[model samples]
Target: MVEEAPYRRIAAEIRERIARGDLAPGDRIPSTREITRDWGVAMATATKVINALREAGLVETRSGAGSVVIDRSSPQVEVVIQPDVPAHAGGFHVAASPRLRRAGEPELNRDRVVSSAVAIADAEGLSMLTMRRVAADLGVATMSLYRHVPSKEELILAMIDAVFGENPLPEEPPADWRARLETAARQMWQSFAAHPWAAEPLSLTRPQLLPNVLPYSEWSLGTLRELGFGVDEMMHIHLSLFGHVRASALNLDAELRAREDTGVTNDEWADQHGDELEAVLSAAAERFSALRYVAERGFDYDIAAVFESGLRLLLDGVAVALARREVSGDEQVDLSVV
Candidate 1:
């Protein structure tokens, strides 16, 4: 129902080119930035154009390859003209390599729509995700995506199911409980790192019921249940483990975006801000004991080192929890409950 004025402009331009053989299906088109520079438009406007082409089934965003036209011979190509791209966009990456569905296929469904949405989020950010934006990416009517999902929230939840489902954890875990949990954490971390945008929609305390996510929960709970804990206790422990991953993963997306925007690491940014930090420290050192202590320590720690240390500390806590479970009458838990 929503109308996209800017996306319409993008669709219109690309349609003209395709019809003229200036660009063909399977041909890689310029990236959003390239398109923006070529067309002399703002970055936001450029992003819309590419997304629109994607929705129309004319283009697809591929890592290392950029955006490519979906296919050369497809059924829907003749029917779809310049579809409008509604203003605004958004979403996170699902997988490093996406399975290209095809160009101009009538068999489009929810999975394809959500898949494209995930691709956009992977390439861009969650703030840019919208039904209109997603449709623009698919090169379809904005209304077309509505046939499968009702709202962005529903789409996001389904995306989590679809994306997370693609990488299922082991039904059988390793012998060491810590090692098994570490494996689980690493997998989750890789998922976040690959699709940094995945974390933006997730809430730590109020996670939605997802089959893929639930399995991890089942594994965690089963691990605890064998450790002489009741079902409720197991649930609590399961939450704690899940909380660790989600909370840490939450920062992954923002950190990556900050990197892209500034093209600097956190320490680099801090080094650039060193003078400012020095001034603030000088001013507040007298009032704050913590500031005086660090100043007296006379050390500037690398942020990357700090991040790694923090990660170690987090895992250390898990190790401690496991150790406590061992000392207690708690029996060994079977973590692999797939």
Candidate 2:
């Protein structure tokens, strides 16, 4: 006789849509903002609606992307709703997907857990990643994930290691030191580009000792060591190059989040504010002549392009230093060489 809670009512409606095939698997459901706008509900109520659906195994939240219907058709995974329950009852009966099954059945293991976590992190920023989310994606119970991965922190470390492993260092790296360094730097950058969320957790002060990453460090340091630089210089050079790449890679996630929130691309945003930008620059024409000049000419801001330029500049500086070290034993090399 009691009226249903707002969230349960909203969740039931969405569940009905999924049942009627109006929302299929992998289709994004309404965002919190969208739900609030459509239903005239508070943000908290909208959030509860999403959580309820997620708990019921009907949707999975992707970080910047809204919640999407999870595929339930796989014979390997199954979800059961209790029969004869009223739509507003707000209860779901679920059977946990087995971690181990018959020979032909898919088995949950360390690799599956790590890989699923990585995929989630890649799509949604690490902020959206949770054990429950990963289990939902894999069609297993949240607790089942803990059996393979001890904790969220450990799961993150494993994810990083797995990504690094994707681009293994060549068994026989390039013979030239410059080529070798370039190759190493590009490999690291590629990994960062593919997985934008990876840059932050890989701390410089407390570096994760990933198996695949160590080979890169060894190769970079060894490249400098061959140039007759001492261990100190070699380490410094390696860290410097790494810092450069990491600093640039961090932008990928920030920009992605910005775009998602604003629903506009960088160029589109620039276009929208073009007049305002020009007016600001024009007002301080004399004081900000250089800025005004670039603005007038139209600057194209590309992250990948900026990263490449900085990388070349840093490597060039290293090259110049090496040349100087060779020439004067103490004489400075001309900066023009770069």
TM-score winner among the candidates?
2
Summarize candidate 2's per-residue lDDT along 1-338 as a digit string, tens digits. Answer: 98778888888888889989999987988765567777889967776676667656677655334578877665655554433323433333345312212235468899989877887677556775778767756656789998999999989988888898988888998877778988999999999888888888998888888887889888998888767777788888999999989998899778976675556889999999999988998888999999988887888999999999998998888887788786777444343432
Provide the lDDT at 97 for model 2.
18
The weakest ten consecutive residues by lDDT in model 1 span 89-98
How does candidate 1 score on lDDT?
Answer: 0.64
Least accurate 10 contiguous residues by lDDT in model 2: 94-103
lDDT of 1 by residue, 225-310 (tens): 55556766666666666666666666766776676555587668867877887788788776776875775565664433444455
Give me the overall lDDT of model 2.
0.77
The candidate maximizing lDDT is 2
